[model samples]
Target: MKRTFRLSFYVICLLIGAFVVSWLIFMPNGQERGAWRAETGGVVLELTPLKATMFSETAHSCHTVIAFPAHMKLVEMLEGATVGMNGAQLELAIDGTLNTQRFDRLDALPENCTAPDPASASARDVFDAAWTAMDEHYAFFDLHGVDWAARRALAPAPDARMDDAQLEDMLLAMTAGLDDGHVHFGSDTRGYRSPAERPGWIPEGSNLNRDMLRQIAIANAGATITKSQTAPIFYGLREDGIGYIMLREMDVDVPIGGRSMDAMATAFANVLADLDAAKALIIDIRYNPGGSDTVSFGLAGHFIEAPLPVFTKTTRIGTTQTAPFTAILEPQGDAPDPRPVILMTSKLTGSAAEILTLAMREIPQVTTLGEPTSGGLSDVMGFTLPNGWGLGLSNQTYLTMNGDLFEKIGVPPDVPVPFETAPFLDGKDPVLNAAIAEASKYLQ
Candidate 1:
């Protein structure tokens, strides 16, 4: 029976290797031999002897990079194309399959093709450039219910008579119409930031200080606090044996007292030692806005025993092409104890903070409490308009492991706790109280 089992295992390994090799050999590497469709439509953004880049706003809000074949006819067709012209497209037969792409609008031709002087360009020039740029680069118009074409049509024509201030107002209004929190337009003298209603435990501008929170936790929960010098991690053990940790932010740089060391990692290791000894832990992330996701994954390592798949993301490659990928949070070191943990969240918990919340939820022992997270998970990309104004927009979409898109929609908690400023101001944290109560049951 031992020999039979070994033989079966060897056979399975061989089959797996064969499957991998076949996949590598047969997979489309984006370069397939096919006949070129000469007459296609798009706005030529860049053209060179070896490659061509074009933008198609009507079909997909992205630029397509195409490698030129050695065919003279294809090269001539590309050379004949003019940048900022709407009439261009590509039809290619790859691996015996035909695919066609079309781009309808051109915002601005390449700088080499037609550079507009920012100081003298008409308001119409700036408006058209901004509109075209959004049409090509802004990825979430459909998701956010933005009618780009209608917005463009409604825009007042850029008059040469308009001053810089007037042009700025028009452009800012155009961006504000999108209603995306990530979308913003800024120049030297003025700026416009889109507003979002975030659900946080602490009210905005309430000034419920972090130091006060530490005092409240220590006094109310009978906890001993250990503050880290390298990172904003305040942790301690409660008298009831439940561990408490509050992470303020992820991106903190501190001196290591003349030693070449990773401060965040060292701080996390020390906190994990204290947490491992406790029967349970309460992680507070209410005030955290966001930072690097790597820090969140490092914290997740203390509870998860193996690599955990947290979320999936897709980036727009072309007008109709999106490349999807999964992000996995790998365990960093050995977790000595996988005890129950209660995570506290708020509306201020966003970006990497929200990602950490999701990662913690993958652990069976973790129970999340408080209001839902601030839904701003998508990745932001920046574009510069003709007038040197910068625009930031969400270009990538993130989804949960179960394939749920939570962009602009927060991740709800397992236990809902409404935020009340009065109770917190009085030094009575109802959320933390409930968490302690819940943890006591797990400890017992």
Candidate 2:
């Protein structure tokens, strides 16, 4: 009996040991646990493993391996880089894993690949390579309605006398070759601008500075018709107790609580409060170049009765893997009975503004007027390029509540108002006028 009892105890111990081994074998690794604050270059960033896979085809020497870090998606790592993680330097092999070799033995890539300019390679050559690669790889290239070959053929000549504006125009032409609405060229100082020139928007003798442009934009927003003074940003006539607000850009930072957000919230609230007694609202962002979307939502919430999904964006994991798009919503605010709303847009409005419009587009009481928007409906995270130029491109594609993609094709207007020159010249907006005419029916 003693022998049998001892044997049973040994058997139970063996079983427990096996279970422990199994658990360890199947447990998730540190990489699978999600985002962690990591130190890189004396700066700490929220780091997450994008995707790590093992490739074991050992037929050739120097096993081939690849690794894509989350930061790499935002900023490309230098070639031949020895990635450091968890206090360990990782070596890449052709075999698709990072743990194959010694620290500092592999190469590290500089900001722009650390590759010296090829022998006598001009900026034009670099531009060509980038332009061609973008044309080939950018998603939704065909929908842009641009002639890539023709534009490429018109490459800048040797010793091209390109001013900042001309250089920007050329870059714009090159980018248009990709034809993705979300792709654009932005200034290092200014965040974004109109890709193509707008009529009378540029001020005469206006130096490229904050004060000069701010004054011009403000005057455009509130210019009087009787005055011969040129105002490019805005000009409107109040009608039927409903004041039409047409805007071209919202790029300026509006301080809120001494922060940009505080300013934006105040601006949004003040705009609505100023027009409180109005029977209807026409928020015309037809040529709006887009701005902070959080502000768009705060303003949009004023008209919504319930929360609704506005748009979504996703991050790419690697060449093949992609993360799910994150969704944003329009929250309901304390507006009295939700005022009737109408929005005007063109192939120009985008980003945060697009998200706002999409959320309100389906409501029965709200109607979108004018032509389709720019179709650049994506969530962008801005970063400085290696050349000290700031860029904000689509990091994720946005989808509507009904699972519709609004990337290449813009949001269609319920009432399509074609562009007319005479009304614009006379400072009478056809889109706003139409909205007022339509709202008059509801108000009556």
Candidate 3:
């Protein structure tokens, strides 16, 4: 029985050898030498060069047989003499090294390739793809969308062989394709500032456009016709013996009662004292981007005698956190008067401003009016790569006081009013007219 098994194994081996030789003889010339393969988090990329290369001829007798693990696009691997693969964090490591970087065939795969991995696409990838698509498919690339050629022209010549710092600048320009809010390079907290403070990190002539200004204006257009400034407190007044407050941002110049709240509680007290019927109040938080929710709740306490859930946050891991809120009418005064109150909002309102809107909904005396808010309400966290490129990812979901989701969608106001055009064009807001009208009716 052993002798018969040995003979059968030899026969099988002989047949496999014959088949391999026959397949190799009929295969196209040099098909085996130019093959490349890679794996990016289980997604495989495979490439085969059609022609013979000097490196392939020297590596093996077949003159064109190279094996690669399939993880990325085949064309991208073939275009390079050296290939680097990034892991889940975009940490780079060499995947394959080649003898030469030249490809000499018309049908050969082109340089600069990408694979279609949905989950692997980072925020930077999304920005890069959006730009490259418009650059290639737009009818007049130079004249339309963000200027791709102009941004790239700022880069040194390809053969210039740039250092890490120079290369970082080129990458920054390349990633600025969408030119949208919350997407920036170098640093995460590079706040929008006056033109005189433009950093040297970015190339020249890259100024904000009308679209960018529109985004900022809409977000800042809270519930009143108050003056616009980057400062936290803009204008405050006592209207009809009622407390009226206009705040652009959450940061305060001084702590409120030494509690370290970002809201100007002292200023709020001073304004409240000036009002006779200060029982009712108006808070214009339409353009407020957001700040410490602690301040939001501290302000909320003035309205509610008892604590109420202002908002809740659910992390990506499913843990829930609830914050309580109330508002104070006056410092060292009685509890917030439950009299009729008006809170203003607009499409430019977002983040903590949205939370404040929802929290007010819990109070029977408060009425919110205006338009839908700017829907940039996702809970995002900043991440910086080893290469110094910054990114923001939406990892957690936010819910309003009433268990309402605020991701991508913003708070909807009780009353919707369209802003008049001419005033808006001249940078004079007309939304305040609508809010004042609504508040006046309730106050009367």
Candidate 4:
């Protein structure tokens, strides 16, 4: 009887041991824990086998990996990245994923997340990784009007038995048909711009700066200006009761842990207060490279008096798009009396700025002048290739209030003008003068 009882006890212990071993080796998820924190925002991340969740006091968001991989591969790729998460998190929030925080930096890594160097990753693995990521989550396969499957078939060296340059060229070829500037991939040392530029764009911004734009406004419009300390915003009053605001980018420069929208709001209020006496406003986003959508909407709100249907957003994930979410821009913060407001744009104005332009278009008093916007309206969804190459792709679509698709086709101006440096070279500003002229009619 004693021998039989001992045998039963040993058998039960063996079964328990086997179960734990399988869970650890085959599943490998039980070890994952909270490993990283954003440099700002008090946001923390919890990474599991195939999912990432970010949370803060007031917000929580979850993002799932579309194509599952062995646990360590994802960790290695992430560890290789020096920047991102802000882009990753924003990609979700941009397309209406709830409560995803924009984090510029992560403070740590998953403990014991050791893997072979990414250099040893085969080209086939990298290629397959990129292809699957896009196929599952890329939002513009229909908009770009190309068969993504074909891109995969056409990928050179289908075996991925090539060198880095060859792999990059193959990857670039895959995206050559996409009209999205936000779509690009690269390793830590090298990069490639989109082979296709927007219809009216310089892949690089127009190289205009706020200081130069401010100086020109002073020269041509007899303007008095002050640059914002908290952000890349500059504003003052121009002659003939016109207000001028030069937005270098839809971004602010607050320190780590500072709230960007709050900082922008304070700066915007100060600008509005100074230009309170003006009858109209000239807002130049001609030199702006887009940043936070929150800041963009926050600033745009100051120019309106009523809530309006602005834009609709949709995101692609795991082979399907989420249900469309439409948004309204409620009148927020300080506002001037309803009067003409000109949004000056160049091909340089994009992303969040383009979304801002779309919002402003709904208002009766707003007019967009100068060149068309960059037309890249989607947020840059972030990913990591098997080789640890960082990848960003347009994963969201922003439709107009009437459901117009405006991805590659930029936001058309109410008053379009040819983009040329000649006006600036000759000590004149035609776009500014034209905007002022347009605003004068409203004032009269």
Candidate 5:
């Protein structure tokens, strides 16, 4: 009986030992249980909110978005950080299935580094500042084939005897080499003009007004005039069963009578309803300076039967990094009946107007007529010099779906109608005339 009891005790001890061995093997170690490591290092360029974007020398990459662990309070540590600083590093420790991260080390920034103050900076300082601004933010140096370093060498250094006017001229000459129509440098006293030429038809002094243009279009088409002075829409059906709508500009509210988008859309719908029986439509955007892109989308929505991707824009976020986003036109209201649509364009037709043309071109039945566009589609970023001079530069690029760059190269017309001032002087619009003839072909 004693031997049997001892054997039972030994058996129970063996079972307990087996359970301990299994627990040791299966249970995670305290140090190894919930730990992961991810690390990237780069020169800090921009720090906003909980995001840090940097230019890393190893990969030659910029605008890398690094998310900080909430527990680390890294953003607070970056409060003193400044742009153009080098030797910035980040380390993150992620814990467990929750994947919560903690900062291993977020070093405080040194106080010695800061951007130069533009307020009291010298001429050379101002020039250098402007150059650096473009170097860091301008989106198209390589695309424009501009040797920015070479241009910097050509800039005259600030001398104690130099006047503001001379400094302005030097800065102007430096920017002129870029050949970008969007680049501008100016002070209250004077400004620099870009030599880039815009292609379009410009009527003589008195005939340049919209009233005269409307009259010419009306007389040429033999169409009764239905106009809203407030909405600034000129629309009617031609006697030959062709429809015409002339939009001078796209604005949410016009100064003439406080015209709103709803009013504009209503006006558009009314005109289309009147011309519903017409065989074709002619959209005249000649000399229309572009306004809100939202307005352009709203206008394009009426014509598109489905959601159409028009173009995409890429903005420079670092010296060599860019972020791209797309703009699409969603169908709004009922889609108009598919018909042959001719869009009239000129050098004066630019910005949102050009965007409208791009959206319209996506429609299978639409054709762009007249001269090439003004080629100013991208949004401009403005900068101010330390010397109180203001500068504007194109900091973004726009492209079509097939990846065509149209910054300086305007959108070409399918049917080219070379604009001549003589035709307008003689009470004739050859461009409009050409569109009418083109529409007639589709009707027959």
Candidate 6:
């Protein structure tokens, strides 16, 4: 699985076998002097192309396909390279999937290429390389209230006598004060990560599968079964005149992933159309880990009745941040009139799922219940240590429209209720139970 650099602890990636027209650039664009450009339509992204063997036949083949097992439509079939010095410029919409790709050879700096021989560098050299990279690219020091300079000063340096293990410890110490989950340190084998919040992992031994949900909807809700658009997304009406749309995550079918936002909006429109007869609606995201922000926005747009500013974000460059980019939400495609809506959540809900919660909270008829979402925001941007080790950090910060920050602190539920997997083990759902009871108030 392959995903964008802007990932939470869990974000997946994959795109269609694009690059068929593989716009190859052997010479410089004469723009960046040493760099070249490969343009495509979609999200603006710079992809690193590792060294590829050139036999004079040109770039061809999906030699290695990386898949990100997340809940998103974002995917790319990356092939060919130039020692990671080459990069591609992808033009993806603010809410579009990346189905196609391009390739370009760029003569860039060493950090963009593979690391130097690990044996050639001292333990201290590797540590310093990591420290310097963060000094230049890491983004959330201010938000975490961390004095990175002071912290760096106090950090224990790797001594010549220290082994690789000790060096790893020293690197981990550099960001211990920062509660950003995006922070990461890794060698060829071992690794360490600082979680933004706790209790965010999925519950153990939980069997919340499509089969289970289908059984519950049929046996208890007395809903009609339609063997269409199965799994991932489920929609139907309950015996008590209530409707539900339980999405496993903000994902899409591969075919649909290559399309535009209108495609996703139309999918939701169809689901809502099926639930049109119900008196109230229940939207469950209790098990969703996360995916693309665009997919989340696409789903949320269906319920949004008016243009509303939900969240603002900015990239951290050096000590300052980039200009703020605020995301607006409004109705798209066919949407039902405002009705009593329940959003069931849990610690598992994070990344774009958190974005969805943030967006839904603004509506008057929507009430979020169950556990708070995972506080893991920001994309995990990656860097290469001098010894070829991997270093990841949060280089962006997302905030509410009112400028409220929830980093390391999740979005709280309007009605807090602990969800238990044991209930699912017994062929029941605690989250659904709570939603059903809450739906009582709106029942006419």
Say which candidate scores most in TM-score. Answer: 4
Which lDDT tens digits does candidate 3 get at residues 1-444? 999999999999999998666545433334323323211110112233322222111000111112343322332333322333222211122211101122222233223222234344343443443333223322222221566566634544424544445544555656443322233334343422112112122235543333433343444434233332323544434444445566565544432123323234444444455444554566777656665443454455566766564555443321322232222222222656555667777655655566567667677778877666554443333323322334432333456655676443457777777544455445555566565566667555
lDDT tens per residue, model 1, 1-444? 999999999999999998666545433223322222222222343433334443322231222323343333333333322222223433332110011233332344433333324676566756775676667656677777777778776467545566667766887767764645567776667877665433344567865765566566556655777877667788888878899888877654434231111345556778878666788888888767767665676667666667778777775554853556677766655453477889988776777788788778867889999877777665555544555565566666777788887676667889998778898788887778988998899777
Is candidate 3 or 6 superior in TM-score? Answer: 6
Query: Model 5: clashing residue pairs?
Result: 118-386
Top-lDDT candidate index: 4
Structure candidate 4, residue pairs in collision:
none
Lowest-sum lDDT 10-residue window in model 6:
54-63
**Superposed model 5: Cα runs more than 4 Å off:** 1-121, 160-167, 187-190, 197-221, 254-267, 319-323
The alpha-carbon lDDT assigned to residue 369 of candidate 6 equals 93
* Runs with alpha carbons beyond 4 Å of true place in candidate 6: 1-122, 137-139, 142-147, 150-171, 187-190, 195-231, 256-263, 335-337, 418-428
10 residues in a row with least lDDT, candidate 5: 94-103
lDDT string for model 4 (1-444, tens) is 999999999999999998666545533243333245433222345555444544321111122223233343332333211112333342122211212433433446434223324766677666666776677667777777888887767644534578778888878777777877788889668877664333333324663454565467557765766788777877777658889888877776644434555556677877787888888888988767688776776677776777777888876645566667776775667563465788898776777788789888888888889887777988776665656676787877788878888787788899998766657656678878888888787677
TM-scores, all models, native as reference: 0.65, 0.56, 0.48, 0.71, 0.65, 0.67
Better of 3 and 6 by lDDT: 6
Looking at candidate 1, what is the lDDT of residue 1? 100
lDDT tens string, model 6, 238-301? 8788887777777654342344345556677677778888888888886676666666666778
The local lDDT score (0 to 100) that residue 422 gets in candidate 4 is: 58
lDDT of 2 by residue, 363-427 (tens): 66788987777776654423322223333444345666677876666788888887655544444
Minimum summed lDDT over a 10-residue window in model 2 is located at: 55-64
Candidate no. 2 TM-score: 0.56
User: To one decimal, what is the Cα RMSD in angstroms of model 2 from the true structure?
Assistant: 16.0
